[model samples]
Every structure is written in C-alpha cells, then in structure tokens.
Target: MPVRIGGLASGMDIDGIVSDLMKAERTRTDKVTQEKTLLEWTRKAYTDVNKLFAEFILRTRESFGLTDSSSGFLVNQSVRGLKWIRRATVGDVGIADVSARAGAANGANELTVTQLAANWSAASSDGISAAGQSRSNLASQFGLTDEDVVHLTISTGTGTKEQKVQITIENGMASVIKTSYGAGEDGEDSVISLLSGKDISDLSLKELTRQINRADIGVTASYEESIDRFFLQTNQTGAENTVSFSDE
Candidate 1:
C-alpha cells in the first residue's frame, strides 16, 4: 500500500478530484456498452429480413418458371396460351347441365341424345325379411350360422380392367373387405374394415347402408323396409361401370 497525502502538501482536495475522474470513466464505459447492444440488435434484424426475402424469391421462381411443367401459369412456353376460362350452355336446363374445360373448342357443338346412360343395378329376387323386422333378423333369413364362413366377391368395371373385392363373413359378422385391381396395374390390395368386429344383429338397416357406402367399393347398397328388399347399384353411370356379386 502507498501512503496517501491528502491536502498535506498541496492543501487542495486531491481525493475529490480522483473520485470525479473515476465517475467520468464509468459514464464513458456505460455508453460504449449501450452502443454495442444496439449494434447486435440491428444485425439480428437484418438477418431476419434477408431470410424472408430468400424464401419469397424461391417460391416466386417455382411458381413462375417458364419451362416448369408443374407451374400453373406456364403452358407450352406461353403464358397467354394457358387455358383458364371456358363456358357451356345446355338447350334444356331441366334435362341436364353441361360444362366444358378451357382447352375445349371455342365454337358451339350440337349434341343429340338418343338414350341416357344408366347405372347397372340389381335387387334381391325375393324379400330378405318381413316388413318392420330388425336388421339382426337378416342373419336367420339368409341362413347364416356362426360356424359358417361365407365368401362374398363383388366386382366392378368390365372385361380385363375389372377390380374385385372379397369380403369374408364369419360368426354372423363381416370381416375386412379388400379390393385388388386387374391386369396391367400394380395389383396392390386396399383393405377397408368397416364391419370388422361388428355383429350384424346389432346394426340397423341405415347403419349397414352407411358402412357399405364408406367402403368405397364403387357400389351403393340400400335396404327398403317398405318393400323388404335389398338393392345394389353402381355408383357411376356408364357402359364400363358395372357391379356384380357372387357368394359361397
């Protein structure tokens, strides 16, 4: 330690002067620290803005590419050639409605309908059960037993392009239904388990209809309680659209 001569020789306030100098130094240091913090925040803001601009540029390039086939605005290397508008008119609006794509011909075309297309449909030859009977009664009427295993195959489409869905029935309950495509396709089977673990006796006619519709088998099934018959129809109207059923 050094001996401090406070106003002994100079007779002035030396300690007060030193304290004032230290206060000035502390103020300068605090100002530098504040300036450094402001600079860091400014740098961060610029980085965030640059990131946003980069993303926007990437998306714009993808959507507006001249040669990009997936770009909706470009068609055959010409943006004006893109088909984005079309209009159609029907003579009899009540009979049918018509629509045309933008790529269709611009001139009006006359069409004559000799016969309307019909959807393939079938109904049970006889009543499945008496009127006002519960859906559970169908098991007995169809002669289904808990020990019996019934294999039901439903097919759609025509000729070589047909797709078949097979449903297995056991213990008066239907298992998962799987559909496999025909030749020239992947032949991968898609499985739908709408009736899995469900007892037929516990389901109502409406509930059964809902389950069958959700199966997406290209067929719709309905039960008419008034006529006591089950009806099945193809979901689409065309010559190629057909629905067939075979059970054993």
Candidate 2:
C-alpha cells in the first residue's frame, strides 16, 4: 500500500521538504558505513598479524624439529647391522641393545655404514640460457608470449616438500608479478616475490642472478656470458632435491 498525501491546497513542496529532512537521517547510515569500514580494517589487521604469528611458529617448529610432546628413539629397518644376535654380558662392551641384570651375561657387536643420499637436478632450455639475456627475449626463446606462464617446480625431501612458482608479466608493464594461476600449493608470495615489477628486458644477467639467489630455495643460478651459458645447481647434493620446468 502506498501512502497518499497531497500538498496542493497548501502549495507546499512537501516532497522537497521531506527530501531535505531525510538528508539528516542519512547520517545514521553514513556512520554505520564508516564503522563497518573501520571494523573491516581492524579485522584485517588482526588477521594478518595472526597469520604472521602462525607462520613464524610453523617455521620455528620445522627448523628445530622440537615440540611440547613426548618422544622416543626407534631405529628404522634400514639399520641392518643393529639387529641384536646375543645379549651383552656383564664384562662386555659394544654397540648392542640389551639388558644386563645382576650376574647376567653381556656381549658385543659392530656397526657399519653403507649408502649416502643424493640430490636431483635439471636445467632450463639452452635457448634462454645465454648470459645477460633479457626477460622480454625469454618469451620468444621459450615460445611464450604476453600473459603466458612459465612454471618452475622444485621437490625436496622425497616429495615431503615441494614448491611450484608461476611467473607472468604484469599488466601494462614488463615487470614480474606473483600469480596464483599455476602456483604450487605453498609457492605464492614466499617463493616468487623477488624482482617484483622490475622489467626483465632491462635487468642484466648479474641482477637476475641476484634475484634467483634470493629466492632461498637451496639452489643457485649463475650465467657465464663468456660461454653464453646459464647453470642451475642445488646447494645441497641429494636425490630428493629435484627440479622441473614447464611453460605455457
């Protein structure tokens, strides 16, 4: 139902007057809107701080491998020579897991080491592997273009940890930007935020080398202009440190 009120007889601009009156009422809405915006900002700040703290705790845990929990030592099956053949006697001393009580017999044993771990490695296409190569030239060398993607995947610790970084040119800029289109599960801002917004065409080989080194992925990239070659090597030698690449 619509309310009908005519101000014809009084010749009053009722609608205009009401509109003017309503202007003051909008202050409530405006205040609410402002408060809502402030609340959002407060929430964002709290959330960001919380996330940063969470990340700090997680990294600390991973680095030290320590926690507020009970722990025990258990040798894995890989320890071949550690299998106890006989109990240690009271007068024997060797690498043996046994219990010697009052007047109990004791024995001795030997231990041996066998194998070592190795890391995996891979190289990018030699087309873009030249020293002092510009990023703009990379598209043509790798058969990529504007808005295309180049993916680099690094696997560590038998796939327990893996990071994939997706790269693309910024809109209306020749600089680099971190994108989510093909980024690995844990490879967003942390792994590929280096050299952000810097034009690749303008960045020298030495500068690119610096950025790659700063990525903290336990790998180093160096360019040798004298031989027109680029090399990617792992900081640690182990088969678990695998590197792979793709472009689209």
Clashes of 2: 10
**Top-lDDT candidate index:** 1
Encode model 1's per-residue lDDT on 139-245: one tens digit a residue: 64455568878777777875455666666667877654645464334765555455676665564555666666766767888888766788888888877787777
Residue 206, candidate 1: alpha-carbon lDDT? 58
- TM-scores for every predicted model: 0.51, 0.37
**Which pairs of residues collide in candidate 1?**
none
Report the lDDT tens digits of candidate 2 across residue range 23-116.
8789888999999999999999999999999989766643443332234542222222322432454333433344433344454545553665
Candidate 2 lDDT (Cα, 0 to 1):
0.53
Off by over 4 Å in 1: 1-90, 94-111, 130-135, 141-143, 158-164, 180-187, 204-206
